[model samples]
Target: MNWIILIIAGLFETGFATCLGKAQETEGRESLYWWFGFGSCLFVSMFLMYKSISGENAIPIGTAYAVWTGIGAVGGVLAGIFIFSEPATFWRIFFVITLIASVVGLKAVSS
Candidate 1:
């Protein structure tokens, strides 16, 4: 259950980050919506992270956190390119793959 929460938190981390990018492009009334969405996701992610760490030891928690961060970062980059017209390059994909592999390795060793 805790692990599930942690995973959900990770997904929310991605959501908040993507919302932040979108919010940056807005100005008036619409900006408030994006800001509020980002804030809510951020708060939830942090709360879930706290719950997850409390339920697990530091090593596993930390491992899960690192993987979650990797997922968020990669997901953010992809979102930026697809949704915001940011550049998508082979190098970017390569780095994302590397990050994913690192996450997998971290999880394997920690488990």
Candidate 2:
């Protein structure tokens, strides 16, 4: 359950990043709206992360954080490619795959 919450929080991290990117490409009220989205996602993401570390058998902070940022980083790159049409080069995709493996490995070894 904590892992699920962690994953959701990481996804919200992606949401905030994507919103910030959207905000960058807009202006005036439109940009403000994106910023609002960014803020909302940020809050939710942070709150979830905090929640994930609670309870008796909470995840070690180091592992939890690494997984959280791992998900966020991978999601960010994918968002940049799909949503923002950033480059989908070989090396980028390769690294993304490796990062995903690393994140999953972190989960597999964690208890």
Candidate 3:
């Protein structure tokens, strides 16, 4: 359950990143709304992270943080490609896949 929370946190991290990107590309009320979304997602992500690391089943901070950022990084890259229409270059995809594998590897080796 802690692991699940961590994953959700990471997804919210991605949400914040996406919102920031969208905010950058807009203006007026729309941009303000995106900024609001960014703040909300950031808050949720941080709260979930704290929950994942603070209880009886708490994940080790080192491993949990790595996985959290790894998931966020991968999701951000994919979102950039699909949602923001950023480059889908070979190296970008390659690194993203490796990041995913590393995240899985971290999870596999943890308690």
Candidate 4:
């Protein structure tokens, strides 16, 4: 259950980061929404990560964190492309897949 919460929190870290990126493009009141959302997610993620680390040793915690971040990065890029319509090129997709695979491989080895 703790690990699950940690993973969820880590995903939220990506969410906040992506929200920050989106907020940067906007102006005035609408930007506030994104900024607030980003901050809230950031806080929650950190708290959850702290809980994870407290529950587990450094190695597993670190490995899980790295994997989570990698997943988040891929998710963020996809969200940007689809939600923001930033860009969606073949190379980008390839890199994202590579990153995902690398994370999975790391998790497998660590486990």
**Ten-residue region with minimum lDDT total, candidate 4:** 52-61
What TM-score does structure 2 among the candidates reach? Answer: 0.97
lDDT of each: 0.82, 0.95, 0.95, 0.80
**Which window of 10 residues has the lowest lDDT sum in candidate 2?**
55-64
- For 68-94, candidate 2 gives per-residue lDDT tens digits of 999999999999999999999999999
Model 3, position 65: C-alpha lDDT score: 96
Q: Which of the two candidates, 1 or 2, achieves a greater lDDT against the reference?
A: 2
Q: What lDDT would candidate 1 get against the real structure? A: 0.82
Candidates sorted by TM-score, descending order? 3, 2, 1, 4
In model 3, the runs with Cα more than 4 Å from the true position are none
Give the range where candidate 3 is weakest over 10 consecutive residues by summed lDDT: 67-76
Q: Model 4: runs farther than 4 Å from truth?
A: 56-59
Off by over 4 Å in 1: 56-59
Estimate TM-scores for all models: 0.87, 0.97, 0.98, 0.83
lDDT by residue for model 3 (1-111), tens: 999999999999999999999999999999999999999999999999999999899999999999999988998999999999999999999999999999999999999
- lDDT (0-100) at residue 111 of candidate 4? 39
Model 4 Cα displacement at 59 (Å)?
Answer: 5.7
